[model samples]
Structure formats: C-alpha cells, structure tokens
Target: MLTDHHTHLAPDDDPLDEEALSIERIVAHVTAAMDRGLAAVAVTEHIYRFRVAKPAWAHPYWETQTQWDIDAYWEALSEAKAIGFPLLVGIECDWLPTGQEVLVEALRGRPWDLILGSIHWVDEGAVDYDLYSAFDHIDSEALWRGYVDRYARAALSGQFDVMTHADLPKSFGPLPSPATLGWAYDAIADALAAGGVCLEVSTAGLRKAARELYPSRALLERCNQRGVPIVLSSDAHAPADIARDFELAVEAAVAAGYSEVQQLKGRDRRPVPIG
Candidate 1:
C-alpha cells in the first residue's frame, strides 16, 4: 500500500514556513493525496507551542504563532473528514525540557491518529537552523552526539509516538562527518524500542543535498537489529509532494529487513504489510 504519513498544507500565498498553513489549503492537499494514489496520509502540521523563546522585535512573525489551539485542530479534522477523504489528524509536538505533564494532559483522550515528537529547539533556544548552518565551524562530532542525546531524551520522556527523523540536521546541509552520527544510531534505535516509539523514514532527506535518507543505510541496519518498527512519511509541504518518494523508501525498508510498517488508527498503532 502507498501511504504518506507527513503532510503540510497552506494557502497558496502563504510563506514557506510552518505557521502559514490553513484549513482550506489542508483540505485541498488531502484531496490531492487521494488523487495521487496515496492510500492514507497524516496531516501532521507543526504545533510548537512552547513559552521558551522570547522573540525579538525583528522577528515579530514568530510571536503571531505562539498559540495553537487543539480545538481548532479537531475542527479542521472534522471538516477534512466530511470531504470523504482518508485523512488522519496529527501534530508535530516539540519535546521541551519542562511541560511534559502539561503536554501529556493536553493530548489526553484526543482522537489523534498519530503524534510526532521532535526536538526542534534545545534548552538554550538553539534551533537546528543555526546549528546546521554553522556545521563547518563547530565540532561536527560533538554536535551529532548532542543530537543523538536529545533524541534519546525525547523518546524516554514518553510524550511522542514516533521519532520524527533521526538525522534531521542533514536536511539543512551536508553532514560534517559520518562517524559521530553513525555511532549514535544504535542508541536511537534502542531508545525507540524501549520507549515504544517508531522511527519515521522521511523522504525529505532524498531532496536534501546528500540524496539519501537521513539516517542512511547503516542506521537502518541498526534499526533492523533492534527490531524497531518504522513508518514512512513524505513530509510534503504541497499537494504534488504527497508520496513523492514513497516507492524508494519502501525499497529501503525492505532492504533493511522490515517487512511491515506502522500506521495509526484512533491513537492505536497498527502494522501494515509492506510489499
């Protein structure tokens, strides 16, 4: 079955940023996914609602999106479902150092199909956007080690359903060195298994400079060894991008010895046969 588990939708004129999405554009994107032969897709819009960052006056745009109401999210979900398209409601929640209980309570008893836990901003408010851009100057090994450490912490916190992308920094630019990041893959895999979290093989990596998945082949091998389940997501921002490189991801999964992949149905995970 062909499915893309990560998609974002926004008005045509909206900026190419997370906060620019709208419900009207989301429905359009969902229709596009159905037309493009996607059996199912998750509408995982960005919901990084943390009170940590103090936006400067220069970045006034950041302040406009400080609050993302869950009630509004479900309303959009209801509207999308009325269109008779197979769409799932999910959010890419940020894993903050504090507010674990608040986050859990906010999501409690919600009809969400999936939850993606990601570490976008570190404690010191260092976003990966800056972290990846300064790769050459910084110690690449130490940076990657820090990323893995954060991933473990994100998983162990018991807040997210899937580890969104293990090697997310690679999305920004060329990876500094493989040895450091490669060594941490096993820890991430083990963490996923222990925390009952799945890994998302995002196709955005192929569109990156490296033209390979984020974690690469060696990391997939470690995931296989640890028996960690996986899910495939296109991380599509527009309609045409839905399921963009899913076939290649399926091939990669099979090569990694995973015969089945995961999906969500009413907050419960169900394995779908991958052929």
Candidate 2:
C-alpha cells in the first residue's frame, strides 16, 4: 500500500487562517491523495502554526506565525475522520531544546494518529528559510553539526512516531563533504533505531534547492542497515501537492533496500509492502 504520512494543510509562507482548516479543504487534500492512488494520507500540519502551541517555542518567527486555533484545527479533522475520511490526524512537532517540557505538555492527551518530529530550527534561526537562516548567524559546519545533534536527541526523546527530512541542513544548498558527516548519519541511524522512531523518506527535498530527496540515498541506507523503518511523504502544503514526486521517493526507498513502508493510526504503526 502507498501512504503519505506527512502533509500540511497550510502553506509555510502564510499564517494559517480559518479557511485552511475547513472540512472542505481537508477533504480536498484527501481526495487529491486518493486520486494519486495513495491508500492513505495524513494531515500533519506544523504544531507551531497553532496558537496553543506557541508556548512550546520561543522563536520570534513562531510568534508571528502562530495565530490559528489548534482546537478548531482538530475539530475539523475529527469531523472529517468521523465521517469516514481516509486520512489520519497528525501533527509535525518541532524539537526545541529549551521547549521540550512545554511541548510535551502541549501535545498530551490529544487524539494523534502520528506525530512527525522535525528539527527545522537550530537555536533561534531557521534552517531552510532564508529570512531567518541559521547560516546567517552560524557557519555551515556548525549548523550541520548542531542540526545532527538535535535530530539525534529528538529521535531518542521518544515523543514522536517518525522523523521527517533528516538532512534538512542541506535544504538550501550543498554543504561540506558527506565524508565529514558520515559519523553524523551513523549516529542518527543508531538513535532512531534505539528510539524505535521511523525515518520519513520525503520527496519535499526534491522541490528544495538541494534538488534531492531528504536524507539522501546514503542516509537512507544507513537507517535501513540499522533497522530503522521508513515512511514515505511528499510534505505537501497544498491539496495539489499530495503524493507529488512519489515515484522518485519509491525508487529511492527501493534503492535503499526498503521493501516496506509504515502505515500509522492512533499512534500505532504497521508495515505495508512497498510498491
């Protein structure tokens, strides 16, 4: 079965509004995913985009972006799910060193199908966005190292079901040689296997300046060798983007020796044969 567990209802460039969480919009995404022959899809919006999740992060960028109500977001998704929509209710949770406790408290007791752990920000600067790029304040090598360390910690935190876009540090462009980061990949694979967290093989990177899939084929092979299960995602921010470039994602997974992908629901996962 083909499934996409990482998807965003709201665009990253825009602050989420009421229209973004409407039942109509949610169904549109699901329908698009189904049209692409996806057996399942999950609407895992960024937690920082919700007003209630603001206390979990101290970044100024989050302050300006967190304006929508999380309750309404959930209510809409639940309504869609209640009516038998073929979608999962999930959230893409960011891993912040100082806000770990607050983030944990914020996500407790919710009916989450999956929680995708991501390391978008390394300290106060964003890794992918140029407006608050971490490269502006830190050197490329330091940023890469910091991102790897944070990702390892996030995977071991045991708070998420899957880790998305493992190589986000290179989203904007190329970095130092992979030889310099080989140890980081090994460490990440080990942490993910130890934590029992599945690694997301996302096609979103194909759309980024990196022009390659997230986590690279080398990292995917490392994770596969460590027995870290995988999930496929497009990281879609719009209905039309659902399952975008999934052929390449599947090819990459097969090339990495992944014959199965995980399907998630109510925080539990089951393996499905990859096509």
Candidate 2 per-residue lDDT over residues 142-203, each given as its tens digit: 78888888999999999999999998888764585666578778888999999999999999
Clashes of each: 0, 0
- Distance from true position, residue 106, model 1, in Å? 3.3
**Model 1, 140-258: lDDT tens per residue?**
56556666778889988777777887777665544556566667777888888888888888887888666788568778878878888888888787788888878888899999999
For model 1, the run of ten residues with the poorest summed lDDT: 50-59
Candidate 2 lDDT: 0.87
- Residue 152 of model 2, lDDT score: 91
Point out where model 2 deviates above 4 Å.
Answer: none
Give lDDT per model, in order: 0.70, 0.87
Error of 1 at 131 (Å): 9.4
